[model samples]
Target chain A: EAGVAQSPRYKIIEKRQSVAFWCNPISGHATLYWYQQILGQGPKLLIQFQNNGVVDDSQLPKDRFSAERLKGVDSTLKIQPAKLEDSAVYLCASSLEGGESAIYFGEGSWLTVV
Target chain B: AQSVAQPEDQVNVAEGNPLTVKCTYSVSGNPYLFWYVQYPNRGLQFLLKYITGDNLVKGSYGFEAEFNKSQTSFHLKKPSALVSDSALYFCAVRLYTGRRALTFGSGTRLQVQP
Candidate 1:
């Protein structure tokens, strides 16, 4: 089985610019998630999707960040008017529908906003 | 609100010695605990989880974690540390009730010396 896939292992953008990260989860996985991991910190849940609908996104910055999983197999996270504080690693993970299942993760996209 | 806390920022241990990484969590309902490992420039990997059942759960790479419901702690442990086991470890928790989203700790960096 293939692992989760993420694009542009590294990215750099100026403040106020827009950036996007892509993620393709493991085949047959029913749940997908996006997380932000700042330096010296653990991964923070940005959003979670079960199939095409969102399960949770309470912690996401609604004003600047948005994510979608249209077909439910792949997802894209976007940040508009990126700020220096947004610089972090964007990690994507997938898992089964059950609450206790272990989640598989991708390599992640490292973003640096200057 | 569910939350996790890793008390130590870093831990140093000599190879072949025992190692432990402490974690504590808070939640309203039953808690689902997880441990993940991240190597340099890599995404988080599932180490183990404790949803229910036994108190001690063994996971990949000779890692194990003890779930203490009374103390609300799930500390990662290994009997004999290896140099290759040096990495960043994160502890996470989720509530069993509605709208479950993972709450992660800051993370603990493990350094194993030869």
Candidate 2:
């Protein structure tokens, strides 16, 4: 089976610019997630989507980051007026709608704000 | 809140020797544990998960984990290490606050010397 797919494997933008990352989850998977992995730290959940509806986004920075899943299949995460601290990898993952199920991740979209 | 911990920042083992990466989790009830590996510049790949019925969960690439409820630990082990086994390993727990989410630990870097 094919795994999750993400675009723009790498991106570099000037500080205070805007950038967007896209994700397409595995087929038939009902749960999707977006995570930010900064260097020297673990992955932190930016948002989660259960069939196009948000499940959790408490850790997300509402002032600069936003995400959406359309039709429960594809997701897009956007960051506006990016900061140098925002330079990290954005990971997209999918699972079969349960906590017990293992989540498979894409290669990740690397972001660098200069 | 449920969480997992990888206390070691890095682990070093010689090739052909046994290896162990420690992980511990904290949660309210029965916990679901997972192990994932991340190569440099790559996303997380699922290695194994412990949901129910089995304390010893085996996963890809000759990796296995033993779940100890008494200790609240799920430690990843390999009988014999290889140079290619070097990577960053993460321990995660499945949580159900409102919806399912996976919370990961800081990660342990495994280095194998041939």
After superposing candidate 2, which stretches have Cα over 4 Å from the reference?
B96-98
Which residue runs does candidate 1 get wrong by more than 4 Å?
A: none
**Tens digits of per-residue lDDT for model 1, B60-95:** 999999999999999999999999999999999988
What is the iRMS for every candidate structure?
A: 1.2, 1.7
Error of 1 at B106 (Å): 0.5
Error of 1 at B22 (Å): 0.5
Per-prediction CA RMSD (Å): 1.0, 1.1
| Cα deviation of B48, candidate 2, in Å | 0.3
**Please, what's the RMSD in Å of model 1?**
1.0
TM-score evaluated only on chain B, model 2: 0.96
What does DockQ give for each predicted structure?
0.76, 0.74
How many angstroms is residue A12 displaced in model 1 relative to the true structure, after the best TM-score fit?
A: 0.8
